[model samples]
Target: MKIIVIGATGRVGAQVVTKLASDKENEVFAGARTPENVPNASNVKAFKIDLHDTKDTILSELPDADALIFTAGSGGKDLLQVDLNGAVKVMIEAAKKGIDRFVMLSSRDSLTPDSFSGPNPSPLANYLIAKHFADLWLIKATNFDYTILQPTALTEKPGSGKVTLGSYSSNENSISNVAAVLAAIVQDDSTIGKIIEMSDGDMAVDDALKNLI
Candidate 1:
């Protein structure tokens, strides 16, 4: 299977690239604005993709693939440009290119703009609002078989390959664990059209996902 991972140079995105590349049958195309930072490997290839570029340019850079995983963000810098509109642009391009599978890395409470907690009267509010609409647009407006993974409080802890899904998202979610789940979801068609909120838990990752069915 071939997969394109946006934000490939990012923390969770990098782990997803390496994890996907570990599978001999899988080929990973890593997309980043700064392509040089993407890791070099046999099954992994870097491509130039700037979310801030023209929509046509983004489409041109994105290669033909079986799936797309969107984890790109501006770290609260350019919320509208890089987070909301940027994501929608990629989705539009993916649809134009006939790419049907999509996976998004969103945050906890993104579905509820009011409940989302961040610094009082800060970008966090707008970030959640952006995510709220992005996820809604994917679900309501697009025909793609999409999976939206909403996790909370990403951490740097070692991955235990354990997680809780379907329940509300809350925990110190390790970036590794989140990446692993993102990797696994791309290969599982059952996850299509599902919105999964997850976090650290005692159940194995695979097991937790199976419970979703």
Candidate 2:
């Protein structure tokens, strides 16, 4: 399958690219704002994608792909630009391109802003607001299959190869587990059009996906 991964330089995006590229049957088109940060792989082709112009960027790179994986987002002041507006742009372009399936990497509760942590989540958490808006828009948009994976706080520890998949968000997921789940979903046909929330648990990734479906 031909798949395009946005934010290929990011923590979870990078790991997904690595796994996809290692598989001979999969072709990975990895995009990052900085080309140098995108990892090298025999099957992965890296390119620079400006989040500010996500529609054009994706239109230029994704026509040939069967799926698009959206992991791109900004945390600082640019979060609104890159996460909310940029995300909607990408999804819109994907619909125009007739892309078969699209996957989004989102934060836990991003779709339900009222459930956000703290009476005053930092301004930085505005990123979550943007993500929530994007997710809501996608839920209401037309064309193309979609999957939204909402995971809790990300960590850098090596993956435990375990996770819990459900419809509700929680604070228990690890970055490692999230990455593993993303990679698994990229290859799993059953997860299309589903919104899966992930958290750390003793269940294997395959088992998690199974239970999720």
Candidate 3:
């Protein structure tokens, strides 16, 4: 598989890119706004990409990719620009290019529509709303293979080398554990079209997803 990872410089995206690139079965394109921050992977090439660009940075960097994984997110200033519109831009480009597999790294807050209806949510909540819209757009945008991984309260917990995948639950997971889940989803064909919510668990990432429909 030829995979492209947006936000490859992020805390979790770095792990995902490195894991995929090390697999002999996959080749990786690591895209970041600052290429220097992207980790060096043996089978990966780094590219500088601004998701906020109108010209479609993802399209330009990964024109022939088989799978596109979006991990980029805007924290405070402009959630509408980076998370919503930026993600939409990539989805549009994916549809135009016929990319088959799309994986999105979303937040657990996206599972609840009321996340934005609270009494003046924090800036981070608004960011989650943007991510929610991105997931919705991808779901409605194409018939190609897709999966959304929603994780809660990310921690720095060392990936217990395991995870639990299902619908939105009250369970929480660490960033490393979530990274493990992303790695599994990218390599598994059976996980396509599933919105999987995950948490730290006793089963390995691959095993947790093995029985996932």
TM-score of each: 0.94, 0.89, 0.90
Instruction: Report the C-alpha lDDT of model 1 over 74-155, residue by residue, as the tens digit.
Output: 8888888888899999999999988989999998778875566545643467788888888998999899999999998889
Q: How many pairs of residues collide in each model?
A: 0, 0, 0
Return the lDDT, model 2, position 150: 86
Regarding lDDT, does 2 or 3 come out ahead? 3
Candidate 2, residue 95: lDDT: 81
So what's the TM-score on candidate 3? 0.90
Candidate 2 global TM-score: 0.89
Off by over 4 Å in 3: 56-58, 118-124, 167-171
Question: Across residues 146-177, which tens digit of lDDT does each residue of candidate 2 receive?
Answer: 78898877777777887778853345666667
Candidate 2 backbone collisions, by pair: none
**Backbone clashes in model 1, listed as residue pairs:** none
Error of 3 at 209 (Å): 0.3
Best by TM-score, which number?
Answer: 1
Candidate 3 C-alpha lDDT tens digits along 82-199: 8899888888887778888899999776857777777876446777778878888889867769999988777776767767677534366777777778877877888898888777
Where in model 1 is the C-alpha error above 4 Å? Answer: 116-123, 168-170
